[model samples]
Structure formats: structure tokens, C-alpha cells
Target: MRTLVVYESMFGNTAAVAAAIARALGSTDAVRLELADDRPAIGDAELVIVGSPTHGFALPSRLSRRAARAQGADASATARAGVREWLGGLAAVRADSAPFAATFDVRQAPGAVGAPSHRVRRRLDGLGFRTIGEPASFRVGPTAGPLLDGELDRAAAWAEGLRGLAR
Candidate 1:
């Protein structure tokens, strides 16, 4: 089945996690990977996966937005928009064609803080999509971080497990 992987990344950690998930699903050529900037066309995709980096305990926290603006008014290219905004604007899916949905996020370990993935899942659920597993999280090393070692492989495994559950 066709799948769409959408993500928002500040330091590329979330983007890497999204890529790993797309790869686990199948050939990169077959899966559509999108950054949150553009409104993604879900088309006939049977599965939809979304991701973002956790900022200030939420999806694109206020502080992150302020920081991005501080980077530059032209920081749109690097910071762009975030997944929360993208997901918030999604048109409601019809009941018949609503795809199986899932979400993931990248963040620091000891994950007590809230995550973007949970909010993504809730948004998908409210849009009438059926979710097939718990949201996933991949760890980053620091605030603007390279992901923790082996996290990509772990992400792949997590995606594989979710695929199994969906079947």
C-alpha cells in the first residue's frame, strides 16, 4: 500500500526518524516523504505517518517559534512551519477512505515531557482515522541534537512492529 510520511524538524533529528520509518515501510522510491511546509496530498495512500520534534513539552512550543523568529525573519527556509500547524489544518477525511494513522516524535530521554506524537495521533483520530498502535518516540542527544546512537535502527524496528500490528 502507498504511504505518506510527514515530518517537521528543527535540527534534522525528526526528519531522520521520518526517513527511517519510510524505509522500514518499503522502498524509498515508493513511499512519499514530506516536510510540514507544504500541505501534503494524501491521495490514495493507505497509511499515513506523521512526526515532529518535541519543543517546550509540546508540538512547536511557543519558545521554539520565538527562537526560530530570532534566528531570522527569513528563517522560513530552515524552520519553515511545524507539524502541529500542518496537522491542524488538515481537511477531515471521509469515513470510507480514512487511512490507518500513526505518529512519532524526537526528543530528549527520560521522556516525561509531553510529546508531539500524542497530539498528532489525537488529531488523526479526531479526523476519523483509525490508529493502529501507540505513538513512538526517538531520543535526541541535546536541544539541537543529533539523535542518540542506534535510534534510527530502533525507529525502523518500531515501524516494522507497527506494520505488523496493522496487518
Candidate 2:
């Protein structure tokens, strides 16, 4: 199955996780990994996975969106939109089809204040997508991490589990 993995990465941690998940699904040829900044078309994909970094009790909080825009001010149009904006627009663009969806987020180790993936999952559900399973979270060693050891492998395993749903 073709899969689309879209992610927002402030410091590349989430991007790495997204890459690992895509790799887990299959070769790069089978998976399309995109940064939220890319505004990738979700067309013709059997599975769609979205991910972002947890911020201020939510996924891509307003403050983070501002920060991302500010940091990427000179970047592409989509880069300034961030995951929140991409997701806000997703329902409309994907209205024609419902794909198996999943979400992931990078956060402080267990006991963090929020799980961005949960919020993403809720939004995806509200948009009428059939969620494959519980949203997943990968831990970061620090705010700008180097994911906590083994998180990539864990992410890959999570992606592998999605195979049952993808099929």
C-alpha cells in the first residue's frame, strides 16, 4: 500500500521519526515522507500518518505556530503554515476519501503535560477518517532532542503494526 507520512519538525526530531516510520512501512519508493511545510497531496495513498511536536498542552499550539512561522519566515509558503494549519485544511482537501489514519508526536518522557498525538487523533476522527489504532508518542531526551534512546525502533515497530490496518 502507498503511504503518506506528513510531519512538523522544529529541530528535526519528529522528521527523523517520520522517516523511520516511512522506512518501516517499506522502501522510500513505497512511502512518501513530507514535511508539513510541503503541503503534500494525500492523493492515492492507502494510509496517512500525521505527526508533530507537543507544545503548550497541545499539538502545534498557537505560540509554536508563530515560532515556526517566524523561524521559517523566508521559507516556502507551506513551511510557514505548520502542522496545525495543514491539518485544519486537511478535512476539506481529503473530503473525497477516507483513508486509514494515524498520528504520532514527540514529547517529553512519560508524564509530560500533553500528548499532541491525542489532539491530532481527535481532529482526524472529527474529519471522518478511520483511525487505525491509538495515536502514538515518541519521547525526546530534551526539548530539542535526540529522541530518547530506542524511540526510533519503537516508532518503526509502531509503523509495522499498522500493516494489519494498511492491508
Candidate 3:
């Protein structure tokens, strides 16, 4: 199946998780990994997985992106548009059989103040994608994180589970 994995990152933790997910789902061939701010094309995606660093208890706004970049955009790239803006600009497409979708978020902690996945899931649903399961989250130990140990493995495992659902 063709999977589209889109992500927005500040310190690159979220991008790392997105990459792990795509790798688990066969990144080299089937998965198309992209940065969300680039407004990645959702074309021909059997499964669409999106993720970002939860900011201010919701999706990142332009202000938040700017703030994050100030802290450190990391090597991958800072999100200029953010997932919120990208989703907002995206045209809703209703397929004959709604395609599967999932969302994940990176946060300060599991029960931290932010959770962007739910809102992202809702937006994707609005765009006519069938949700695969509950949104997922990966935790970071600090604000600028080298993601907590094992998070990458966890992300890969989560993607493997999603792959089963896609089948």
C-alpha cells in the first residue's frame, strides 16, 4: 500500500518519529515521507499518517512555529506553515471509499498539556478520510528533546500495527 507520512518538527523529534513510522511501513518503496509545512500532496495515499510537535496545547500556529524556530529549527527544517495551516489550505477530497488516516504527536510528556493528534484526526476526517484508530503520541523528556529512549522503537511498532489495519 502507498502510505503518505507527513510531519512538522521543531527540534526534529517529531520528524524522527515520522521517519521511524515510514521506515516500518517500507519507506524506501511504498511510503512517501514529507514535511507537513511543504503542503505535501495527498495523492494516491492508501494510508495517510500525520504528526507534529504539540504546541500551546493544540496544533502549531504561525506564532508557535516562529517561536520554535527561534529556539532551534534543527537540521530537518522548521515548519513555516505548520500542520494547522497546511490542513487549512488543503482541499477536501472525498474518495468513493474513504482512505485510511492516522495522526500522532510529540509532547513533553504523556499527559502533558498538548495533544495535536485529535485535532489533526478531525481535520483529516473532515477531508473525508476514514480514521484508522485513536491518535498516537510519543513523549519527549525535555522541551528540546533528543526524544526519550525507546520512542523511536515505539513509533515503529505503532506503524507496524497501523500496517495491519491497512491490510
**Candidate closest to the true structure, highest lDDT:** 3
**Model 3 RMSD, rounded to 1 decimal:** 1.9
Error of 2 at 124 (Å): 1.0
lDDT of 2 by residue, 1-167 (tens): 78999998777788889989988987533788888767887888878899988777687755776675565522343245568888877753355567888999888768645788888888888887778877898988867677988999999999988877754
What TM-score, to 2 decimals, does candidate 1 have? 0.88
> Of models 2 and 3, which has the larger lDDT?
3
**Candidate 1 residue spans exceeding 4 A from truth:** 61-63, 68-77
| Candidate 2 regions with alpha-carbon error over 4 angstroms | 65-78, 92-97
Clashing residue pairs found in predicted model 2: none
TM-score of each: 0.88, 0.84, 0.92
Best by TM-score: 3
lDDT of 3 by residue, 58-128 (tens): 98888887788777766357766778888888887777856789999999867734588988898888888
RMSD of each: 2.6, 3.4, 1.9
